[model samples]
Target: MGIKSWLSKPLASWIVQKQKKWSSDPVGTQKNVFDLLIKKAQKTTFGKDHAFDSIQSHADYCRLVPVREYEGFKEYIELVKQGTQDVLWPGIPLYFAKTSGTTSGVKYIPITKDSIGYHINGAKDALLNYVHQTGKSEFLDKKLIFLSGSPIMEKKNGIYIGRLSGIVNHHVPGYLRGNQLPSFETNCVDDWESKLEKIVDETIDQDMSLISGIPPWVQMYFDRIEERTHKKIKDVFPSFSLLVYGGVNFSPYKRKLIESIGKEIDTVETYPASEGFIAFQDIPGQAGLLLLLNSGIFYEFIPVEEYGSANPTRLTIGEVKTDVNYALVMSTNAGLFAYSIGDTVKFVSTAPYRIVVTGRVKHFISAFGEHVIGEEVEQAMKNALLKHPEVSITEFTVAPQVTPEEGLPYHEWLIEFISMPADMDQFAHDLDQEMIQKNIYYKDLIVGNILRPLVITSISAGGFINGMKKMGKLGGQNKAPRLSNDRSFATIILTA
Candidate 1:
């Protein structure tokens, strides 16, 4: 390896050592980190003599700060839009990471230099830990094809700004950055569609060993590659060895993706948001491990059972356990204290703090009072798909809607199928049967006839996910709503 590449390995190794030192001693590490953050916050204008004096003081301050959803940050976002430096933090934020949440309209999350370091280091630690766990160093040498958002940096008042996409584009090592394909200019608004086309065309023949992005977009790229090359992606990119994806559960699309790839590729699931890179797959066979940014933020978990209710118990990293689902809350370096992002996760293990995302706290159908969660729906769908080989779902969504006849509410399914079952009515019946069998709550509701029969709306190939993407609703950490209980979604499904 050349000097730069050789140096990167050592640097990456150092990051791993540093992270292990922090993660292993969660309480002690957080206390020290929190003390330092409190000092910094106190020095800042917004934090000057403001309630918190120490780490515990900071946590207490956060608890009293009144948890704000993404919408609460809109005023700060407007400051960003104006290129003003009057919000939280010292210097002007380096860039804004474009994202949207359930309650938050399109947002531009600020990423300061310090915040960027936390994200980059978290990602580095994840990579190095993967190497340490799997004993595989080949990935470090391979060409990684990250199917990221557009790298275009928008300029405001002579200062370049955008989302994490822009920051990452500008901040990567010069040598590797130089090796990357030409980035799409963010300043040019009209080039967005063309940029995606360019990314597809440039990597069609390359030895792309590692692919990373939202599953839908990654699949879209593969579909584009197939259409352009007139060959299956497996044939075109025969050297593809790993698929690293985040932003949505791959379980629903796993079987189809695996079959399409024609070989088992090492898969890594990441829980990265525009806010920060929260967790990533550490060991080869394990799901994602939560590598908490102990230094950058105070993490809190509200038990899933208490979700949407007032005063759920808050859990620190040291207090979490395996298999219990919790809604994630974070108090970050960039002045967000005790903020709820509304995502839910389940710990796979607590010894090393591994987590598997359960689903969104807000994204569920509850018309029959069954409290159906995203994970439950995904699991039910998986079983249904597995049992009926004749019915291959390309895309689907679930929602609770009130029928016009009696105005009684029920769950509706909008599904796109690659192949229809010979007996359509039996297929629908089996779908309900599998859901009832796998999910007890759903079964109880169905048995009582409180929930209506499974309503299936056939859509075209790649319709649901693609349509969502076209509507500017796709990103790394956001998935098309699997369960939308609102009238807007109901109207769309009915009209479509």
Candidate 2:
């Protein structure tokens, strides 16, 4: 038997057993996880400061710890950077995962030895979950490719720092190394173009069966592969049976991805962040992801409307209701407590809980109090595409033009289209009308002459990628923000 087959049977059994336990008593399991975390770190500085030993219930924990963004944890993190042990967790962090977050420009998220277990085990269980649900194990016998960040890390004080994906690559299990593609040397290449070319050259002839990456870059890689071989991706890898992705809504890029594949393949969505692995698609044909309840992270939800207020109500997993948009707050083994991760989600199921990412907390344009969110803008674009049936957007970002000298203030969309529409004016009008229909505040602003109709700027070829490159955020796991409060990205795109 192959290594995967030998491993899959026991793993699948474990996953099935865990799922039954979780579904049977989700509330009891959640409370046990919370209690274990608090007990584990009661002697640490963060816990002691917050009276963790004295805390007796969920209410006590909530009342003692205020929800905070990374800025609030900056001081504690600085101490970690200087090699302080047992500050946040039991010891200094194993490493810090760096990323470009919305509020904090360059965020350094801690990854403790304990916390890394969650990521590693979560990934293993996710794959096993797929096997348990689908009864498909042939893909496990072939090579799989993950287009990920460079694993090259730089030392900060005594801690290593790099992208989270890169850090995880260094920890791939020994048994599964043969199933993974792209040599370590190529993966460490700094430039994306050079790395992608090397990867295409390395894995083009392998018995590749699965691929995973963020959607936009995956499309770029597939296009490059097809260009070189003069064949579609499926032709190159006949065994390619699954595509795994996350980090952005896949709906906008779905048609293009399917066209590139040229064949039917199962798609699995995962919800992983630098902070922790949250959820993954477990069942075939399921609409939402199964929340990783047993992972080493404690979750809290704050109603979207209550966010940015002085004191938002923080609800535990037991208290969360289905279909309500709530900003995600997490406390993890990495020593982050009651921390806001800046993304929003809506629960689709309460028992054996599942959720779908709704939008981002910081990605919105509310200059004129329209309070437009990423989901609203994306849905509006989707509606416009449905109506026009001729245009396709590769990428887009919206920002406010508050002080345009030639026209009234408006929301400007800088877009890169795969196929341009015949009449740009009508296309823009359709998007504006769709937006008004979706958001009452946007409609009121337009009616009051407080804001002009939305403006569309057709970006030149490679404009968005070039802008991302210039901003030093051009590769794996780093996605361009869908909306920005200021015109920084808009100005860059216009001038690029």
Candidate 3:
């Protein structure tokens, strides 16, 4: 092993030990983060307007500050965009993470001087924890690729603005520069298809070890490699072992991707967003992501059912229970106070606080009385896949078919199949049965004749991919919605 690789294992051990101190006392660590953030922000305009000086506890904070979504919080973000300093955080933000929003056009999420670590070191700690657990540090010497958006950022109002992954791309530590693949020129290509071809060209002959990206995009890379070499990904990069993925559930795409690689590989799941780097899988093959309580963000949970109620219940880390869904809210050093980032999570374990991302708070199918979520639709697919081994898909989505020309309204399944089942009629039956088992309201609707059984609509080859490209949302942190109440996204595919 090289000298740097030899030293990494011990350093990994040290980092994990230090992190354990905070995880062992989750609530106390969060209390410390809360007090520190409040103390630092009291002099800022938001704090003063909300009477932050007199706030002493969660109850006091909740009374003084109402939870806000990005639309509700845009007034403050507008000030930062205008180069206003000390309007939210103590100083001007270091950078703004530019992200697309459905209801609110483009969102500019601030990354303050104090909160950059949550974006940078949080990824490092994830890798170090892997090394500490498996004692494998040799990948540090081989090539690693983070399939991401263009790292080239643009300046606006004297501050940098770009996608979160693109912004974080600029901060990769010096030590990994030699081992990272996909040259900066290749990375800056605006067209995702063209950029992907160049990435395969650059990395095909190198000694690859680590590959990270959303599952769909990773599958695209694997497809390109197979087309050129006529070999599985494992055959092309024999040393490849670790797969790091985030931003969407991997289970829906897992079966097809595993076949594309032609072998099983270790995987790490993460929960990262523009607002914060929330959690990651610390132990390989673990069911839940370990929440980072001691990071510069103080987290809160509102039961998903009570999220939009007039007086929603707010709970700290200690108050959360396992197996119940809750909307994630946090006050970060990044100047966001009681901010709900629109994601809901289920605590799989609370002894040390680990969670699973359930769905977006707004992404649900409820045109009728039945309000079904992302997790259920995903679970239904998982259940159906188990019964029919011949079934595999490129991607799929669910939407309420509220109006039909001939029959009662029903749910619609838009699917792009890789290997179609011999009988799609039976396949749809199995999927509908699974959905009914997971969601009772949908079952009641079907039985009462208010809704009919689901209809599966097939998208032609490369349809979803082309639709994304048409919208200029082809790659890098862009995810297809699992469930949308409206037909806009589904129409993009159905008409394609």
Candidate 4:
């Protein structure tokens, strides 16, 4: 074997040992991280305002700083934006991870010198875990592409600002730089279509062993490759072995992406956000990503059903139970305290704390009070895939039809198909059956005749793509919601 194949051996072993050290004592590890974060931020403006010095426990924390979203913390962020020092964390933030928001126009999440390693290490440990599990690393030496946002960034108030992916782009470890593909200039193109075309030109004929991106954009890249080369990705790059993805559940996109690749390959799922890196899948085929207990963050969870209450029951690591959905909250080294990042997760394993991202807090269907969530819809689709091998779905979304023109209200599923089922009525029947089985409320609604059986709307090929482009969310971390409480997305899909 070449020397490159051996490089991951020691690194993987070291990472595994380090992870085991923390995983072995999940509660204590998190406690230490919590104390360190609180102790370090005591002098900052936020800490002083929240009386951090007097806070002694999670109960004290819950009382001192109420749970909030980005808007609630915008006061400190604004202070930092105006050249305030020691406002959020110690000194000024090194970078602001600029990300889009539905309510807040543009959010600037702070990252400090002390906190930068969380994002960097989050990526590293995930890849190393893959290496240790598979006993292979030669993919590191071959050409690879990270289909990410442009690396180019700007400075605001003397702090660098860019997408989280772009901020991390500047920090790609030197060892991997040698094999990174799609030249920097191409990556900096800004316009996704133009950048994608340039990326195809740069790497189509070169050796590419790894590709990483959100599923839809990655699918776009594969489509472009097949269009140009007239070959499956497996045939074009036989050595390609790993596919790393995150930012969306993979089940809906799984069959389509695998077919494009033309074979099975190892895949890794990561849970990363501007707030912090939450988890990574540690074992192959495991149900959920292992939570980062020793990372520079203190975690909190509020039962999803109780989140809207004036005083919700907040639980820390040791207090949480398996299979219960909770709204993920965190207080981080980056200076977010009791902050809600809008994601919901369920712990599949509590002994070592492994969690599956169930859905987003606001992304659900309850127009008729059925309260169907993203996870239920995705699980139903997964069952559909297993039941109907001939049916291939490319993209799909669910929204409530509260006021149908003729009949009682119902849920509408818009699906874009690559291969249609021979029996359209039977396909809808199977999908509805799974959906009803997964969500008890939906089943109740159906039985009471408050809502009718869901209807299916077939979308032409590239329909969702055209719709996303129109919404200006066509690439780089953007994803179509699997379920929506409103008809905004449904309108777009119908028109597209």
Candidate 5:
């Protein structure tokens, strides 16, 4: 039997059992996972300092281990860099996932054997759930391509360092290597354009069935494939049926992807951070991603408004109510104790605990008291697209035009359009209107004339690409910032 056929039944069975348990007792499963996480790390230095042994309840875990960000954990991370064993977890991490940072230079996230298991299981369950929902396992017979970073790792203080995708690529099991694509050497190409060219050249003729990556990069691949093949992606690869994406809002890229594919296909969204794999689209036609409760990560939710307060109330899985935006805090097997990864989410369902990503804690524009978040911007854009079907935004960023040289203070938008709207003024007006409806603070600012109407700046083709290249973050999971408090990124695009 083929590898997929051999593994299909057992994998499906395991996922069925997991889903049964998950739906039945999410809270109990969460508690068990939390206890397992603490027990596994109890002998470590972080555990000792945090009093993990005495942590018997969620409240105890919260009280003992305060919510921390990367800055707060930097000292311990430095210790790990200096070859300290068991500084955070029971042993040294196998690798450090180097995250691209806009504020900080680079963040080295610990990737232990236990943590890697979480990543692998998350991917497995994502596909297994897809198969369970659709009853379509035929795609498994063809190649599964991940537009990922180079698997070649760099050594930093005796630990391997690379992007999370690249690190995960190295761990792709031997059994599935035959179905994975883009030669390892091609992935190692540092330049974005060069990498794209190589990937297109390598996979243009292959029997690709599944493609997974961040939307923008995957779109780039699709564009390149079309450019080379002179046909739609579906025509080029008849078996191509699955597209898995995350790391950015899919709403903006949805039209572009669908247009490129030339037909509808199965699409899955995932929330995989360097810190941990948090959630994935499980049930077909579900609105939100089902939270991974039994993963080796204990989750806490703090209300976004109270995020920076001296003592914000942190809620557990069972405590969170639907539709409340909360910043996610996680204590994981990788030895991060109550670490806040800065992404915000809102629970949409309580029965099985599903959530939608709202925005980032830091990624917002409120320079003139007009607080606007990633979700608001995305929704507004979606609303604009609905009104003007001709236009589609490929990528965009918004910044406050605080010190206007030519006009009053306003929000500045730098947009890379797949197709321009018929009426630019109306399009911009509709977007602003949607934002006003969604955010009361923004509406107040506009109504009071504290902020001028938002000004839309059309970015020329490849503007985002050029800007990201200038920022030294051209590829490999690096995406353009959607919103910024300042015009640093927008200025670069405007100047370029």
Candidate 6:
């Protein structure tokens, strides 16, 4: 924590008070928030009255909006580039948060002055709340290390630009910025191979106290560091206090990462995006609290259910139930109204609205007419890993593919490990058994022999995510598809 962070307790209280006033009201709060956004959106040339309508008018407005993906927003981004004031918000936007989605190559998401301030202040509030909940003051004095994307601004026509990278490069507090190590931008490495090398070199001598980033990148950094130093990260950053990360599920990699760190570092998950910072871990022991940026955006949830079901129920903050998954829809300060992010989340509680991200709505495997969700796969995998004491899985990937001769669909598990059972057949059988016990659908499918179980051991040190990173598709909001129902990439991996 920095000096500003220490002084932000009052600011945190102010934000909380405002949040309480808004969140507690529920119905009136949402209407007010939506109305405010509508007033703002009405000013934009692209905005229409239908775009700003309520959740009940979703069907009517959705067609008008036409589900504009990030690519559709590229024109608005170009308008920003021209330094025009005709884009989503008033005046020139501060910076763009670069994020990649399924089809969008690289989305330069506009972050207005107000949006940036909201994110910065929200971050402060979250930190201060963490301090209050944990009953620890050590964080206030320790140096924080944010494992983020390099703050390299791209020069176009002699003007430096690059939305997200520029924001982090320019907006970080000056004092803390000076103490930070080299970013991916500082190093002359544009490709993953050299970038990982640079990351290893920069942190070798730093007195890092906290680490934060996407889980896969963190794993990659530690793996590279270990290879170079012949010591785990615990040996390198002995004073490390916390591991804060989000952007993907951490449960699968938690055990290994904990072991590598050697000491029990406090773990915190943040549900942030290029669009906005939606939620953060408020209390230390409690699950993450969905601190709705009430002033920043309006939110709605659609109950997740099987296909061919009745109309999905739209939920307000008050209506959300614990332990049930919901598809999130948002209308943000930045022009995206009634936007579906394609992610799924389950509420741990409703009063404070704490949620644990269940999985991706797009990343489900439904072979043999059985819908196997990402959470189910993750839970089953975790359970299977717990059964073996000697085996340690560092990373893994699952792809649904059809067997060559039989033309039958099956799941191919690509597992990377430190050690494994010498009898490969027995290991496979045990893993299959564990999966069966964990997920009934998978069990029934296996029992019916519609999907044959298979596992491939990768000898490569960095594992599947590293392979994806090498292809320039890792970090930020982009993640390696954990459950690929499509057989395109699966067939290649299975054959290889």
Candidate 5, 1-496: lDDT as tens digits = 4668457757877886877787678788878888898898888888888898998987787688889889888999999988899999977888899987666678999988888988987887888888877777878878888988778788877789888999888878776788888888898887888999998888888999999999999988999998888899999999899999889988899998999999998889999999989999987667899899888888899999999888899998889999999999998888898898989999999888999999999999989766689999988988889999999877999999888887569988889987898999999899899988999999998898888788899999989988888888777788888899998999888776
Off by over 4 Å in 4: none
Q: 251-276 in candidate 4: lDDT tens per residue?
A: 88899899999998899999989888
lDDT (Cα atoms) of all candidates against the true structure: 0.67, 0.88, 0.90, 0.90, 0.87, 0.66
Q: Which ten residues in a row have the lowest lDDT in candidate 5?
A: 1-10
Off by over 4 Å in 6: 1-23, 49-87, 155-166, 183-189, 306-313, 406-408, 422-427, 433-444, 454-459, 474-478, 489-496
Candidate 6 lDDT over residue span 233-350, tens digit each: 8898877777778777787778778777776778777777667777888777576656564648777677777322344456666677888878877777776765667778888866
Please identify model 2 stretches exceeding 4 Å from their true place: 1-10, 155-158
Ranking by TM-score: 3, 4, 5, 2, 1, 6
After superposition on all CA atoms, how large is the RMSD of candidate 4?
A: 1.1
| Model 4: lDDT to the true structure | 0.90
Candidate 3 vs 5: which has more lDDT: 3
Which runs in model 3 stand beyond 4 Å of their true positions?
Answer: none
In candidate 2, what are the lDDT values of residues 1-496, reduced to their tens digit? 5768667877898877977787678777778878888988898888888899988998999889899999999988888999888888888888999988766878899999888988887777777888888877778889989899999999977899999999999998887788987888989988988889999999899988889899989988998898999998899999899898989988788877877889868988999998899998888678888888878888999999899888789998889999788999998988899999999999998767999998899888889888898888888999899988888878999999999988799999988998998899999999999999989999999999999999998898889888888877787887888888889888877876
Better of 1 and 4 by lDDT: 4
lDDT of 4 at 29: 93
True lDDT of residue 133, candidate 4 = 89
lDDT of 1 at 214: 76
